[model samples]
Target: MAPARKKVVIEGSVSCVYCVMEGGPGSVIKTDLLPGAVVKLQCNNSRKGSWEEQTKTGGKGDFSFTPVKVSSRGAHKCRVFLVSSPRGVCPLIISDGAVLKPAPPNATSPFQLFTLQPLYFYPAPYTCL
Candidate 1:
């Protein structure tokens, strides 16, 4: 018999900086909406195979992927990666689970963003390996 599978949902947002004076560090005086950005999620399947899912940011720079499945006796993880920008000019940048603080009138509000955490499943002691 097969064990029950678990479902997990992964989501996040993307944004870009604005108002640059002298290029170096902290050049961005503020941030604006980066709509239509691509966000990808990668994980391992039960067969030890690689799998990836993608989603696009909306006007609010929000994106979400379908639920991922996990089986017993295996591990699954979905890591978020910045794929591309909306304007095709700016490149993708990996964020440390934190989004850029957007300015007013379309600024992305601060929220509790979650990072990818590895999901592990274990079999029963009485069950065979």
Candidate 2:
């Protein structure tokens, strides 16, 4: 008989920072939380093959994938990508994704939680007069 694989949880968020260049240099004006943004989680390993999963950001720009059972080797090969932005909200210029790395296991929990750096969207280009 084979042993049951351990379960793990992955989560992260998406946000946008507005930068304005009035005279000398550009500066970030404000940061906004993006909701309803689509995020995709992909995992690939030469031995186990590959798979993908997706979820949308909540009202607070938070997104989480359901607990999944993955081997230790497969967990390190996962990555999170920004799939799409909410229509009429923020448009993405670059869609570079982040690699998923395993964090230290929690002493109280049986499963592991993985978090990625917050994905960002570039604001539409603006012309300065």
Candidate 3:
């Protein structure tokens, strides 16, 4: 008999920072939540191979993928990437995708929740000055 697949939910958020005279004595940094930003989640499993899913951030910069059913080991191999930004002023510079981390197991829930570090963006070069 085959084992039943497990359900998983992935969640994350995006943010941006505008730095004026960065690294200087009087430098200033402004941070804001990014809404309507697009992000993508990709996962790989030995049995089903690999797949991708995409979603946009909410008004509060939060995003969550629909529940996905996969082998018990599949949820551990997923990554989240920042795709697009709503503000052209805050272009993605030196952005890196984040690996998903599963929260501690819970007895009351049938699905696992995976989280990624908040992705960030910065204003264009020389624009924040």
Q: Best lDDT goes to which candidate?
A: 3
- Ranked by lDDT, the better of candidates 1 and 2 is 2
Least accurate stretch of 10 residues (summed lDDT) in model 3? Answer: 20-29
lDDT (Cα, tens digit) per residue for candidate 2, span 81-119: 888888543565355578666677776776677778777
1-129 per-residue lDDT for model 3 (tens digits): 754455787888888666646463234466689999888887776677788888999999999985454434576777788888889877754555698787776767777778877787677673463
The list of candidate 3 runs beyond 4 A from truth reads 1-5, 20-28, 67-72, 126-129
For residues 18-45, could you state the per-residue lDDT of candidate 1 as single tens digits? 3334552234444556678777666656
Candidate order by lDDT, highest to lowest? 3, 2, 1
lDDT of each: 0.47, 0.69, 0.74
Which residue segments of model 2 deviate by more than 4 Å?
Answer: 1-5, 20-29, 67-69, 87-89, 126-129
Give, for candidate 1, the lowest lDDT window spanning 10 residues. Answer: 118-127
lDDT of prediction 3: 0.74
Cα deviation of 31 in candidate 3 (Å)?
Answer: 1.5
RMSD each, Å: 16.8, 4.6, 4.1
Give residue 95's lDDT in candidate 2 (0 to 100): 53
